[model samples]
Target: MSLLASEDLAEGTHNVKQGLPDLLRNTHDVTSQWMEENTTKEETELNDWANLPHVVLENVFEQLNEVSLLRAQFVCKRWYDVIRHSASLWRDKSFRFSGRDPRDLTHGPYKYASSFTRTFGRYLERVEFKLFSPVTSSVCKKFQKCVKICLNSLIKTKAHLKDFSMPALQLDRSQWMLYREDMCSALARFFCKSQHTFERVDFPGTRANFDDGYKILYALGYNTGRTVTHLDITDMMISRRPMFDIPQFVECFKHFRCLQELELNYSYISEDLLEVLAANLQENSLQVLSTSVTQHDPHNQVIWGHSWAALANRCRDLKVEFYFQRVMTYEQHFRILLPQIPLSEASFDGCYFADRDWQIRPTIASILPRFQSTLERLIIELPDTREVFETELLSLLSLCPHLWYFKMSAYTSTRFLDKLLEAVSEKRCNLSVIKVRIYVRDYDTDHEEIDLERIYTKYRDLITNDLIDYYATCCVSM
Candidate 1:
């Protein structure tokens, strides 16, 4: 009886609801009708985008590149507010200026890169200006003008930058010398301004001098000495000339206590200089010290065994990598390479010097064993003047367990490959890639010298394989 009474009550409520026409309309339908009646055209057309939170707008703005961001800000007042105030989107990006850029070229070094700094200089953190290349003497003056404009704009809108990469201009020899001083003066002032926050400074191949009591470098070292971590001022002017002073440089080096990676000229590294560096570098931070070798560095016959050993002792992880600008004479090679210095990655562009009088074959293998525990990569570019026996090279490979990549521009043979594969399999060597540019002789031609000359031509040399270098492909594939 109670169940039947409950069913009757439900039926009564359903009938009541249906009886009232106003109640028949759902709450959603009624609300829609009310909104249609009361809302104005302006209120209805309101964009839902304006309701987005500040965090969401900043995130969306951050996705855009500099130019795109600049454009997006003009979309509305809300977007402009977000982009104008946000700091993360502006700092730590690379801006390149080139002749190809569409900016008004007649104005200065480059408006494309400088324009960004000029607009948002207050939010600046990392600024890198990479100039357009293939410059001639006529365009250098314009280049100088552009640099000055860019520098002036950057200085005016001064803010501390973490990374600064001033272009190492590749102008004609006379042209570079003519404008180098003006560039350096501007750079010194820039460096002074950047001293408080300059963490990593790279002015490679600029040959920036330290005359006038080393003012440019002094500002960098003395101001941010303990803070600067990665300094790569390679090819700096530090000679026995009237303006250059080695002792002052040593003092400057003393200030680099926090340096982790350094690349300077091999000529400047004397006993006293390296000693100061070894003493100053923080523990384990100084992993790799790279230097560029010029032909003249061999004359400075300072025994680096003790000083390098001291550095190695302090930072057991230190590895010294040197780049040879020219074919190294055998005596010069021996003089510079010290056993104490840990060499992890080596690039020997040419092993033969002066009519094959100095070849790396016999001596290189003997020297390889010393760096067996450390060496991981080796690149050897040999002139095809003489055919080298693979015995020494294979022996070196066997000793070096860590070697991952090996590239040789040479005459490789079947016997060498067979031995190399056998060695790789036997030792389970860590060697990952083996690239060899195999030189082929034209047997069809009767003139042997002519054939050899044609074979040795820079880019036309066909490999033993029809495709890529068989030596590299075979080793990698296997």
Candidate 2:
């Protein structure tokens, strides 16, 4: 009995040892299978990324505008590195925002974008913000705070912006109860911000105080280490006395050492004021200057030979547009206007030379030769009432060689068209564009007209065949 029991124990031990090996092998197989599944998923994802086209990947990130591009620096390490180093990418994008209340907070589509902008502000190159009505003192303060937040957000990003634009804060006539002082204070703070990040500034029509405008100018001058290349000041409401009396316009401009173009158009500019302005430009880098004549200012009368000659000498290119108070005879007009036409480069707009007393043709013939060589563009606004000037007009065209653009809106008989064809043929005039609007209101209906198409065919070989770029017409019937 003892021998049989020992044999049974040995058999049981052998069975247990075999079972342990099987158990260990099964556990190892399950672990290995799980690891294989996980590794396969990782490899599949990597392969998908590798298969993506290069252009697709680049376009996905590079298609954003300037402001959104600036604000997107914080998206990830890859995006941050891309925008922080690329300046040329942001050159063509415009960045503008409004300064009004936010009435809604729905996270519809741009939740991710809005968050990005808040993260990195003012890396944007340009911004335009709108201001709504009911512009009260409290609303202005709130708007000021919003601007401060945006500015502070921008300052934190360490982005170097090159251009910025904003609208003037409009005043509500109904809300006279609003504090003017508060609004002025808000603007003062706003201008302080504007004095930075701009190389060229234009304010077309701002209903602000003259002092306020000058203050903004002062801030711009004080802040910028060097003056901008171009400055435009226009549409300010200045009376005859106060316009000439102010010295800030001339003095403030002297600060810009590199100013090249200055346009003082549609403003109440005086001859004495212009003289002061010209004196500042005497030896500076000023190249192109434009201004209009207003008859209200007695100081703006034609000291043409002196004032215009001085400016023509100072500027390499000049353009002057004068609105007429009364029509003058061609002889009288030429006396004042001809001397101002620069021999190098010049342009004239919105002037009339009408003479009822004597013949106007000879004076026009004499005056047209000055534009023969150097004039690039001529825009003449003709008198509404018409008189015969066909011979004079043909003579003028005969003198102009290498004329690029010619626009005429006046009365010209069909006889003048024949002369024009002859001049084009004889001179082989290399005209790029010709815009003619013949007033055909008072023509006789019974007469047979000259065929323009026939003339075109006669000189078809001689006519310059540069393909017409644009065409639109309003046909007139007699």
Candidate 3:
């Protein structure tokens, strides 16, 4: 009788478990039915996005890029109204050329990008105009007109512009001359108005006369010298023809007291200019200076050791990059410059040493003691077939306690891999990254051969065997 009772209890429990799903389904159905019937009005009220606070809508619009913003305006009358009134939506806007002819400003995305500034220029803090496609003379003129319009709007609104990028105008010497004066005047006006707030100015591919360039620089010196930190005047065509008297050009740098990074290309550097720079660099504020020597300049003077020493004394943490053509020799320059400058990073490219007897190993070894603590990055590119063994290079590495990055392109023997591993192990160098391009000759075949795979394998072994705690890459050049 007790076994039967236990079976009955089990049957009852099974029946209740089977009915549990039905009970839950009924409850859910009732609740959902009630919600459907009663909450329609509340749902409609909650769906009113237009009723959201203005600030919230502004934030949503800010996330949309320029193209999306144009489409977003057509959503409804209320959204259109929100977008029109929200001036902050246009702040920090960038206008990029989308491979369209600048003259066709009435059509395509350029129309919108160019015209938006007319309406919302007051709210702009940072404006960048990048011309990715090349422009014809007519298109450049039209582009200049648009820039002038934007500058006028900024001036009218009294907007404190922070960053400005001159379009990468790929104009020939003649085309540059056509619009140079007008652009310089407009830029000077803009700089005069926004000097206090300007931080970066990039002129990637633009040309001007020396007078126009001087006017622009004078405006920068008088107005934005202290405020502007990063200035790039690369590939600037000062004239249709070359002007060897770059001393006047160097005079403009005296006013850039607060500059952190300066880049100039296709310019002449003379001893007088170096002396001026040494005297005028505003309290050791300059950090990075990159310039290329004008090739075949009759007026090019040898940079004396004292001039470099004076500049180096003021700018202790300066990183110098000297780009030279085959016309100049680097050994004499480095001999004078390296010992004076407490450089953190240095790069020498396309430089040929006049003194055939001068070896890089000795020059580097001489400066290792002076630069050990400060030097972190070193790049040397010389294709000379001189063999540099591990033993000679290891001494230089041992002195550079803070060295983190090294790149060299030169000729070396098979023992270079073994020697590098040995140096990293023995000296305990702080090299975290290294890239080498070594040219090796197949002596038996009397031809150049580069076994990249073997070098990579050896580098991998160095890391795997705990010989170096860094990233290493090796390339072979034949």
Better of 1 and 2 by lDDT: 1
C-alpha local distance difference test of each model = 0.66, 0.51, 0.65
Model 1, residue pairs in steric clash: 108-146, 109-146, 109-147, 434-472
RMSD of 3: 12.3
TM-score comparison, 2 vs 3, better candidate? 3
TM-score of each: 0.76, 0.64, 0.71
- Model 1, 140-201: lDDT tens digits are 55565566666677777766677877655543246556676776676677667653777888
Off by over 4 Å in 1: 1-46, 99-104, 134-158, 170-172, 209-213, 238-245, 296-299, 351-355, 383-385, 443-478
Clashes of each: 4, 5, 0
Question: Which candidate number would show the highest lDDT if scored against the true structure?
Answer: 1
Superior by TM-score: candidate 1 or candidate 2: 1
Strongest candidate by TM-score: 1
List, residue by residue over 108-175, the lDDT tens digit for candidate 3.
45556557777787778788876555434555565566677778778887777777777566544454
What TM-score should be assigned to candidate 3? 0.71
